[model samples]
Target: MSSSAPWKQLLLNSINSNSHLKHSTYFQLATVRSNGRPSNRTVVFRGFQDGTDKIQINSDSRSCKIEDLKHCPFAEVCWYFTETWEQFRIHGRVDLIDASNSDPYKLEQREAAWFAGSVRSRLQYLGPTPGLPSLDEQPSHDSLDSSAGPVDVFCLLLLDPEQVDYLNLKSNERLAFTTARSVNAYEYIKVK
Candidate 1:
């Protein structure tokens, strides 16, 4: 275990650096399942808001992890830097971004880009629409044409980080610091 001061400085420095987070692809998201067991999965961090500490994660709200959040709001996220051997642990409360909870303009813009990427990632790689059915497979219901255009059902996971833990594998030490909204104002504590 190590003192929190140095780790907090490292955290602030890393988060502020564009290159540190820019190319990072995956983060570990941990949520308590309905059965009260801990469940974790790898998810991509779309972006994080600077002043608010709000992070946006692109995920299907219908996912098991999302459902777990609905049952239990607490979540823990971990990100490891393979090159630098530094790891960041984030403890936060997770919430689903519904129409009422999210900003319309921001959500819509991100959603449009998300839908486009979703379609391109899945359909474009497959070449063309196969002989199964066109986008509007069900005329009675809304069009299933995700390839044709964007949809609104998709949502972004909002993370309100409360505490952060930092670990330097090279130094063989760990430090824990918390935010104001957490129990204390960034106290340096050793975790053994």
Candidate 2:
């Protein structure tokens, strides 16, 4: 963080800000099986917390990808920012969030907003059961219409990133940032 230059900041900001937009297509690769076989898929980049150096993703609970994650936590995410020729690669450990102890009423307004934007909530209303129809589903966007939004229920897939790499084609430069959990503290590093 101390070594980041203006160009680095600009690149990071672009990734963090635009990754979650509706149309940005990104791919995340992970070793989903215990045997270490690789699996890749296109996913929506839900959000990230720069302060915490963590990212959020969404996956259907029953998806094969989720099952693959149960056997392996390692994952790599890649996406190119539009027209910039800069590519971002994120290496991280992925996990499913446990909401068993969650207190819905205790969430702050902003937290609630995050929850609502989550794939779980956006695809399926998070009630006791999965895939419940949203009460707010207007007739215009109803299932019968082609303009309907996503309706597949999904679960929260959180990534505790271990490293991030940024490659700029214009400059032919690469920057890597890493962090790890050790002794209940975060160890940060940069590799150029």
Candidate 3:
């Protein structure tokens, strides 16, 4: 096992990069349903909390993913950067930062996230609930009241990774790392 901070940093840097050509900010999130089926979807990457192992992503409070997380908090996220031919598979437990949480810090974080959202993005939470049968019609944006700020439906998903697998296709290298919640040190093993 290799506890290499630089390698982990490289992976984090790749994830945090802003290059459009790399598609670094998008990833596939996988969750398990109540019936024991796996579901996957693409989600945009949000910034991580400072000095913490938590990674953040936003979602509609009414989305299926929210319900899935409620039923089972564990999830896996896969991210690939074509430019570097590198992929990161993160195994983690999910936490929802929404109105239900009474923690002042978490509540503050949620508000910040809501305010940071673009008008168009924030409008999504204001529409008819997701995953419901619709009339084959779209909600007019003009009808939404943005002045109310983000609705209660806006949620932040905080993923606390238990393990992270980093693979570089270009170099034909793979490394698996395990994280300890109370320490910054990571233990890793090369898979290939």
Candidate 4:
């Protein structure tokens, strides 16, 4: 088997296993802050972008992470599967996929992503927005009754990975794969 086979298989397994589980898609996404520090947060793994090496994630357009990505596109994602004791660390550059983009393909993808969201998921984007302090002890969900449909705050983020490191605790093995974006090929090196 090729060196990247195990890594690819593991990643596919993780995604498949998490498909139906509500909380299984969570991963730690790290971005570079303006002060040269790293900012990390948990984000849901939407899926992989069609016909590309990019991984997809949904986000509120008003979130700080969006602003951070606008300033610095590079990011790293760390995902772990507790049941399998496997981990993947991916380094990549992010692109905001939203309605405002001039690319028709991207716009279509963004719309698809937005439509794929559940009612509860869509409601999250309609609130008082993320990262802002609320004076009220409990915010109301009355905005859900508005005539407007799902808010435009929904956005898709595509992470085009340059490198992926896979670690399997069960076998105590580590492998790193470098991806060629243009050719969609992987060259792997065993780190452990």
Model 3 TM-score, all chains together: 0.84
Candidate 3 residue pairs that clash: 2-188
Best by TM-score: 3
Using all chains and alpha carbons, the TM-scores for the candidates as numbered come to 0.65, 0.62, 0.84, 0.82
lDDT of 4 at 136: 18
lDDT of 1 by residue, 1-192 (tens): 332333445755655553555445467889999999999877766555433456677554445776798899888989887656778998888767643445776666455545545443323223232222112222232224565543333556778777878888888888777666444345657884
Model 1: CA > 4 A from native: 1-23, 99-150, 182-185, 188-192
- Residues 42-125 of candidate 2: C-alpha lDDT, one tens digit per residue: 676655543444566655555667778878877888877765677878778876643331644322322333454524345343
Full-model lDDT, candidate 4: 0.75
Q: Rank order by lDDT, top first? A: 3, 4, 1, 2
**For each candidate, what is the lDDT?**
0.61, 0.55, 0.76, 0.75
lDDT of 3 by residue, 1-192 (tens): 544443458766775563755356778999988887899988877777655667789887888888899889999999889777888898999989888889989988888777766655665566576623121123444455555655787888998888988888878989888876578677667778
Q: Show the colliding residue pairs in model 1.
A: none
Candidate with the greatest lDDT versus the true structure: 3
Better of 2 and 3 by TM-score: 3
lDDT of 2: 0.55
Clashes of 1: 0
